[model samples]
Target: MKQKRDGGVAVTGTADKQPNAQLTSWFVRSGWSKGELARQVNRRARQLGAHHVSTDTSRVRRWLDGEQPREPIPRILSELFSERFGCVVPVEDLGLRSAQQPPSGGDIDLPWAGPQTVQLINEFSRSDLMLGRRGFLGASLALSAGPALLEPMQRWLVPTAAAPRPAAAQGPGAGGGRAARLSEQELQLLESTAAMFREWDSQCGGGLRRKAVVGQLHEVTDLLQEPHPEPVARRLYRVTADLAALAGWMSYDVGLQPIAQKYLVLALHAAKEAGDRPLGAFVLSSMSRQMIHLERPDDALELIHLAQYGSRDSAGAATQSMLYALEARAYANMGQVNKCHRAVRMAEDTFCDVRAGEEPAWIDFFTEAELHAENAHSYRDLAYVAGRSPTYASLAQPEMLQAVEGFRRDDVHQRAYALNLVGMGTVQLLMRDPAQAAHYTDQAMAVAKRVRSERVNTRIRKTTHAAVRDFGDVPEVIALAERLSEELPEVAEPA
Candidate 1:
């Protein structure tokens, strides 16, 4: 006889019997006994569209003993914790051993030599270019974390040979081409193209134009296979760096991770080859943002700190402000309220002092609006993790509304506008304003129809879950939850 499949979840037996410290930690925080958790999981399954799945205290005990529950259960427990704590508790955070984790050594720890960076991008962007929604970290790969993710920064910061091309050698992705000569006009065109891709990524989501951008980045790698004049070479690498970073950022926005890491490392390499420390810092910070999304704040902080320190001499005030804001968000994710506030203050002060046109073209996006949006996120995370602390909630409200207003004022920020609306809605729910929360969520839904962002969808799913769990009795909240459930796909992350 086969094992029963409970509402599409194929039951699997436990494989190990070690103590699960992480799961135990979250369980302890929940203040719920084993049986109570089992009951909640069952109830939550019903809300999540799995009406017949069931668990008992024995199952909970097995989970505590490191037994990985199949499918809906892991997702169910994650949502339960998220609702219980008022923050996102990713399934990976539970420390359950899954098929997704692969073996310990599958991490993407690419070399940081500038030449290797170009080679890496040539191969990666070609592979990534072919990936139509490559999904996140499929077989044979896991989301890189810990030392593997951080070690490359060491080479990037103090590269032995940042860029050297006595003889040109290209990877397979680089089609056979003679030593190339590029003009300033062509370089400028590439730069403008990268800028356009960035704009498209911000307005729409990564899903729509990711392939086009990856194709562009891949072509740049082909150009890098041969040496041009050093001046022209520098410009080529700069454009490559821009495209690679934008590609990584866009992929991340659409829930792609493993390849996103590779692209970012390539971006950092290209930036270094161009002798642009500020651009390298930007790439590192972009990686930091990925870590934060994966619920690895410690990793995010390391990357953020490295970015801040490495670029200190070259990065302008505006860039520094962006770094500080990311720092605040990392601290906030860790629930360090004081540190978060301090970092936010630093970001604000730095932004206030940035002179116009003093920063690079890339730093133009980190205006008052973007800075506050980051700050709002910090406060939002703090409020959620603070678990009923009204102080952070109060702080989140104004800042989030400010971000919403700021994004709404810019038509190009369509995705940001949608994302901020989702954030604002969640903040309202935290403030006990269900009606206002619903109103903002409704606005987010409308805007999101025009933007193709999984990140925005992620926020909406989390917010809707929150509203359903916390304010289910409110008619507006329930209606919004139902609409969201009907509209959004299941929330899936690297775990």
Candidate 2:
């Protein structure tokens, strides 16, 4: 039996008990001052109502040896390192995975292990970063291993009476029982994870790695369900809820509608438990986006309304823009041209109010270029519904071109450019220019090869196939269509 910290373990004689050497190396390479890291962790712990406690280098050393830190401490550690290094650091870096690792039978014995909390926060931050980069590829992959890990984690999070008391009750001078302190090393893990996730979100699509993100969400939810002091529990719940919402969004983007819905429901419950009304609204908005994709215009519209009503007082520009944009999408889908335009105008106005450094952490994905690109999509949709060729052609060309340019320049974003080109192909087909339509469709097909996004590939195939059908006899169109069909066999199937 492997010896575990916090309790006596049944140890077989002569088994190795060395700490993880890789983790030790990572810590040394991070270049953070031990004192500065400790100070940040202590400060964050206080903010979260953790009992004031003196933490030192020796305490951190224990963490490096694989001991999990107590509540609020894990979060504090993450915050401190993230602040210091300007990047995310997950608790796993501190060897917390040993604590969260399942037994031989693949069952995690301690659902609310302190180390698990650190891991959860780290994953959440990573998911955020992934979403900001590439939409939601991570969620698409959730079916592979995410749900399995999450279901069990959620099962563990169901509240229990024997849960540990809050850290504050156990502080140095005032306690019959003292809650354990998180080590400085653990805090650094949290910080590193957050920064890494932020970077990933900016550079890659969340849909591609959603399974890992959901796995993290499950762990956070489990932590929230465990017994902790009210203040500590509340803070944990807020962070978990935010991550869960992001999980749902990434799920939706990857076309996992049912899975996305499940995540959204759980996120809503978590948000309510945390008393985070704004987060709940954000989750609803994410659901609205899913509804729009499914072409359930009425449902999407209602979700938009709910989000707007719920977040009316949040005073957040990004939230307002998301709500308005969702509303605009719903109206456009329903062929309510005037209403769509009005909603879009409101979205634009809300975006204008978004001062730098003032936006909430969650809605950081909306860049100026992305916003205009979305507006162009809404216009294109409205044009289709209204049978207004000129309007569609005018907005589609420049917007799609700009979108393609932005995405193509960055390898991480090239998939999006391909998808935008598919939209461009549709617009060209609508304008009766099969030649230009074929050209853009061919470009989209070419770009699709570099990305693993089924959603983008599917859209490209559909649009290109439609264009081919419209001009099947033309030699250039036939050749382009043939090439695309070979690359994407799904396009050869009947609509």
The lDDT per prediction is 0.78, 0.60
Tens digit of per-residue lDDT, candidate 2, span 8-105: 21212224445646446655776756665555555444433343444667656655564555434443454344333323344444444432333331
**For every model shown, what is its TM-score relative to the native structure?**
0.78, 0.60
RMSD of 1: 7.0
Q: Which segments of model 1 are wrong by more than 4 Å?
A: 1-107, 131-137, 162-164, 167-178, 489-495
Per-candidate clashes, comma-separated: 0, 37
What's every prediction's RMSD, in angstroms?
A: 7.0, 19.6
What's the lDDT for candidate 2? Answer: 0.60
| Top of the candidates by lDDT | 1
